[model samples]
Target chain A: MNVLEIQGLTKKFGNFVAVDNMTLNVKEGEIFGFLGSNGAGKSTTINMISSLLQPSAGEIRILGKDSRKHSRHAKTNLGIVPQDLAIYDDMTAYENVAFFAGLYGLRGKLLKERTEEALEFVGLGDRAKSRPSTFSGGMKRRLNIACAIAHKPSLIIMDEPTVGIDPQSRNYILESVKKLNESGCTVIYTSHYMEEVEEICSRVAIVDHGKIIADGTKEQLKAIITDVKDLSIELKPGSAYSLQSIGKIPGVRAVNEKEGRLSIQSDAAVDNLNRILKSLMDGGAEVKALQEEEPNLETVFLTLTGRSLRDQ
Target chain B: MNVIQIAFKEMLLSFRNRRTLFFMLAFPLVLMLVLGTALANAFSTTAAMDTVRVLVQDQSSGAAQQGFAGFRAEMEKSGFAFTDFKPGMDGAAEVEKNNYDDYAVVTNSGIKLYGSDRNAVASNMTQGMLSAYADRYNAAAAIGAADPAKAATAFQPAPSGGYVKELSLDLDRMPGSMDYYAVALTVMIALWGAMSAANLVNSEIRQGTAARLVAAPVRKGEIFAGKVLGNLAVNMLCVLVVITFSKVVYHAYWGDNLPLVLLVLLSVVVLSTSLGLALSYLLKSSASGGLISLAVQLASFFGGAYFPLGVVEKNSLLGIAASLSPIRWANMALNNMIYLGDSTQVIQTIGLNAGLAALLLAASAYMMSKREGL
Candidate 1:
């Protein structure tokens, strides 16, 4: 079942549309990636979904409840970890988690247990008594997540949860996201860092100028650009090689040699790397090093948007 | 439940803030001490007074002469210099010209006292003494007509110290400087909670924490009410601390109607917090704190926080300014309740505060609802 469904969701600030006719569905148990650069309407869409911004038009449903008509029910099932730190600096980590959890209607021993569980889940159980003022940036981010997830909502929206943290904490947050998805909680993760989205997102959507320009799995998104792959091989100096034979290999579109190095372009769909190497060996070519330039999400993004994500 | 949780969180944050603590507790306490100590003579009825010069018109014949002499002797002891009335002397004109503090006419039937309004406090005291002397003389004559035995003793004169008693406080005791400022500073500082409420609301939006709150299941009204209640709790705690400190340390008299006094103070807190919330919503959050602070300062000044409202003449610019301030209303209500056992303004004060608070809260709620973004 889809945990969240937004149809024709539009939010306009006066004459300018911050989110224009956006439509999306986040199914249960999938980690959905929402990728966009600054001023790309990504935060605006996330805010509308989280009920922080009322849509100028359109509808949002969370866990089968209309977000506007049944806001409490919708919000009760949704968790939002904003990009900025929402935890209070003066409050202890435990108090911060407990306070937010209490707002979700958790109480008594259950509240205490859930608060502790959330702190432990975030890997800050030992520092539960410590205030956020003493926490590192990464720990604060973890605590921010803990505050959102303590109520065990059906869907969690994490907006740039790992923006400026150490690699270790980034990795920890990534692993935590995976763990949360594994436990049957759907997640909508937004980030400017394409690699983070590329690593964990089961399905991805690229938004630009208040609208989604592309939406699919990473592989599918990459497939939107082209199916060509470039392979380069460096040979030993003055090694014997049959350039014509290497070019004649099936799925090899073109081949060129420069300074004892052969650059080959081939269809990305074909698995001809081993055959190419075997043919090179048979041709008496001594391969010193081999390199392949495969397409990544960044390449797909750049090819589709005509600019780097960070540039915007 | 969410409202309460949010309120609790707000209270926690407020209590932890050092600046809020200073304004709420330390600032009021210190201000009360300084103002109360520095202005003690202003509120003191026991302070030494200048001798009041009275020109008496001795129009009575021999029958009232001895009685007049006894009255004159008693008035002389209590800082009064009696000047015998002379022929063709205009006592009223002389008193008006500041040559004498008062003029009196002693006749066979009674003595009429005319006092200058410039020195109203001293004039009122002298009038009370003359009235008491007349009552004694009449009683002595009444006794002489009824029976001759007690006439001489009654007409001779009562003890010297009994003439100038504190009759003005027959209903309740007067408040001293410490007591006055204890109420003044308490009301003023309680009104300062407007800034606290503004900061509480603005900080959430400015710090980006409000998005989380807006995302929660709670309604915007809950958040607003939670903040008001939380800030009110913190401010009331500070006020109580100031009150206790003044009452215990300086022996400031808060009177017997503490519950009513606190009720008046609670209204002040409510109004102040609501004002803060309303202003924060009506204006931009960035400028709301500064505006509210400025308003609180201005109100404190014109509301007689630094001095008694009596210092400002009625219907004058300062008096009109003081009347416009909620602080003045609250201060007047509390003062009346404390020193005069008057609950008349208590109802009006609470009504006005509560009414203003209701309006502000409503406006804030409307603004919150109309707000496009969190």
Candidate 2:
């Protein structure tokens, strides 16, 4: 059975919509990637699912329980690694883990053992007693994850958990998320890093303008951009400006000028490459750097949103 | 963790905070010492600049003049702090000598009340006091007397065997103005008031802790309760340490009853802490909390923590409200116990103070629970 279900979720602020008619579901043990650039309502959507904020208009079911009526019980089986470092700076890492463990109602020997297990999981068992101030930025980030997951909840939600950490800590966190999912815990992760999402997210959702424009397996989303992901051509200038003549090329889509270079978007980049090269040379357009670049998630994001993910 | 557990953790962190410790302990200590000593000195001053002293020049001749003795007793019994002077004494010279009395009470005809003409407030108090005493005494004299001559003469006129006043107080508790100054200064409500901005809500926001808590499983209500309860413990700790020190080391006569004084101080501390915490969550600036804490301290200052509010007109809101000052109640309870030279009179004082404290505390708790302006 699906462990989490959100239907027709809509969040409005004044007339501006933060999340609009969004819908999603996560099967048990699946690593779900909640992907979006900043302000794409990713956090807002997760906040609703996590029961931190009330939904303006939506229905959420957690473990078959109505989120509206049973938020506390819904929260019991879920672990959240918030976007910010939520661990208490004044407390020792172990104590921080213990405090959160107690929040899940974990007690006595179980609490202690779980704290130690979490610390060891994050590879910071030796530094359990050290305060966050004493840890490097990466260590603090790891400890944050440790604190959140100490209770071993069946479902874990991480909100941009690795935004500004060092590469090692980021990798460690990514690995931990993967391990937690492998251990039969459902995971929902949010991040601006496409590579991180591509690396660990089993199924990803590409959101834009508060709507899930694309949601599928990595291969499926990639297929959304089935047109030419790469192309190489040689021609003189003024070769492909007016596509009326060449618009009939079997799988060709649209074309744009990129930094004084003729770039083409088309299905079957190789087949379209032959058509573009043959037509462009016939029409006379210069193509100095003719390296075919394989389309990645960044290109996909730009195609869907008309802007880069990291743009301010 | 549970809310109480979270609160305890907050307390542990607060206890170790160097600035918090200083604000809670050191600042009050220095303030109490300076204020207690200064006030003690102010009360010890023998300046006649303005106190109603009734100097009796009893010239009734033989036993007829002895009437001054009984009259003096009656006036003193009616709460007139008096001084005796000889018939031909130089009152002004004696005042210049920085001796004799703060005011002069010389009885001739009906009565004569005098003070250095410059001090108007003292003159008014003196006149009021002497008038009341005369009313009470004249009525008593009219009631009956075995010897009308003795009552009229012997009782009204008496010799001045250099009748000087006696100091009735425990020498140990005689803290110089500096002593009470230290104690009073410790009663600083700045920390308590600033609690809103500095210790409770503002600081948490400043550090991004509040957002962190919100994202966690903790509810907003739990966070609110935890912060208020945690900070209150720290405030009470400061009050307890200072009060305990004052009693053990200086014997400043804190009602000679630990539980009563403790209850009063605890009430004030909780009241101040809650007011501060509620305001902290209400205001925007961290500095606003600090500013409000200073307001709390200043309110106590106005509450007569440094001096008797009774000497102040009980008409102004602050003055009248000062009757409700936790400091005043604490002082009054202690004074009644000390001046009455017994604990029997303290029951009413303690009861009154305790009741006021309860009311303030309940108001604070309700305000804290309902306040969500921010």
Candidate 3:
């Protein structure tokens, strides 16, 4: 069964469309990644699916139940960890989780047990009594996750849960996401960090301009530009280089230069690297270092949109 | 169940916030103590030196009129000044013109005291003095009649040669400044519960926790209900504490009807919570606190929360505006219950407040539902 199914989802603020004709599905127990630049309608789509927003046009089905018509039933099976630190600053970590968990109808022994379990799962057992105001940013992030999952929802949507945290906490969050997925919870994760998505998400969708520009597994997305490899060469300062000559090189797809570094994109890096380097030397370039780069999600995003994902 | 959970959590958050606790609890109590004590001292000092002027209209014939002279001398000794009012004079008109505090008509039947409602204190004092003087004269007359020689030495002509009939005015005791302000401040600060409710709603929205709340299995209306109930509980608790503290420390009278006073205050809480909910929807989250504060001040000003309603009623526009303030009705109802033990207006005021609360809650619920985002 699909955990979430969003079909032709659209949201408009006045005449401006925020999410346009978006369609997607998440299978049960898979870590699905939602990738987008800032204001790319990622949060908007998440809000619509979480039922926090009324879509201008769309049908969001959570666990095969229409989210709009049966929102309570749909919500009971879903949990949302917002991108922002949504935990109550005045409340203790335990209280924050328990309060949110109680809203899901857990009570008495079950409520206490689950609240503690969630805190412990996030490795915040020792700090459960401390208020979020006294917590470090990373501890607060973990508490944020605990509040969402305390109810043990089948499907948890995490919107950049690891944004602005230490490496240890980020890794812990990533591991927790994996553990949650393993325990039969389907996950929908959104983040600006492409590597986190690539690391955990089994399937991914890239949203841009309020539309899904690309969707596939990590390998499949990378395969869209499988022929392309990025070549970076460090040359001595003020060394002359010829862009026109590099652009004319066989198998070279694109060429650009900045700050004494020559970046060359080629369909076959091994075939064209020697020739590219030879041309650079012929142009009076003194090579300081040379390296070949493999295509990742960032490269695929750059290839598909012709711009850096972070720039937007 | 969801409403209770929401309310409980919100209450915990509110209690944990020291600033909210201070504003909702400590600020009002301190203000009540300082203002109530200061005003009470001022009123008591004034009352000590204040004299009630009575115009005596003597109607007894011949030597019997000597009683008026004795009565005037006795009243003058008791912080009362007497004026001679001739027959057929409009004593009521004179009182209206502020010529005398009250007027006494000394006829053969009895002594009648007349005063406007505003001169209730002076009128009662005058009546009491005249009654004591009559009693003294009657006692002396009885002694003289029993023994002729003793009567010659001890007997005095009866004051005004008449019995003291009745004071033709309501003799309800005036509330001391402390009593007046304890109720007034309670009513005014209780209205701040509306601000507390508004602040709670705004904080949830501003902090993004409201989004999580919205995403929960609870309905939007449940969330609204929870927030309002939470605010109401906290506000009512603060009010109860203030009321008890004032009564204990300042010896403030909260009315003889315990159940009724509580009922009236409960209604105030309802009105305040609904008002807060309405304001939250009407203003931005960041601006709601300031706007709510301004609203409470404006309501207190127009509603006679700081002074007598008469002060505002003197102005035509202000009188009409004051009539719209729930605070005005609540405070008046409380005063009536406390000073006069009158329940006639209490029910009406409670009904008006409850009705207003219902309307405001309805409007708030509609607006909350219409709001698409947190």
| Per-residue lDDT of candidate 1, residues B1-374 (tens digit) | 76778788888888888988887888788888888889888876666679988888887876477888877887798688999878888989998999999899989899888898897877898788888877888888899889888788878766756567786645457788888888889899899989888887678876678888888888888887788789888889888988899989989998898999899999999999899988888886478889888899999998988877675677888878888899899888887777777899999999989999999989888888888554
lDDT of 3 by residue, B243-299 (tens): 898899988888778789888888999998898878878875567778878878988
Distance (Å) between predicted and true CA of B53, model 1? 21
lDDT tens digits, residue span A1-312, model 3: 888898999999999999999999899978999888888899899989888889999899988989889988998898989988888888889989999999999999999999999999999999989989998888988999999999999999999899899999999999999999999899999988888988999998988889999998998898888668988889999888789998998887667677888777777534877788889889898999989887778778777766666566
lDDT of 1 at A150: 97
Per TM-score, the best of the predicted structures is 3
Candidate 1, which CAPRI tier? Answer: medium
Expressed as tens digits, the lDDT of each residue in A1-312 for candidate 1 is 989898999989889998999999888899999988788899999988888778999999998889999988998898989999987888999999998888889999999999999999999999999999998999999999999999999999999999899999999999999999999899999987888988999999888888989999888897786766878899998788787887888888667677888877777888999989999898787899999977677666665665667556
- Ranked by DockQ, top first: 3, 1, 2
**Pairs in clash, predicted candidate 3:** B144-B151
Q: Give the count of colliding residue pairs in each prediction.
A: 0, 63, 1
User: Could you tell me which 10 consecutive residues in candidate 3 chain A have the lowest summed lDDT?
Assistant: A303-312
**Candidate 2's residue-wise lDDT over A1-312, tens digit each?**
889988999989889999999988888978999878888898888877766667789899989888778767777778888777776678888988898788777899999999999999999999988889899888988987887788887778888889788898899989998888888989998888888988998998888778999888888877777654655343455554445545667765545555556555566634666666667666656556676667667667767776667663
TM-score of each: 0.76, 0.71, 0.80
Rate residue B255 of model 3 by lDDT. 71
In order of lDDT, best first, we have 1, 3, 2
Off by over 4 Å in 3: A234-288, B45-172, B309-315
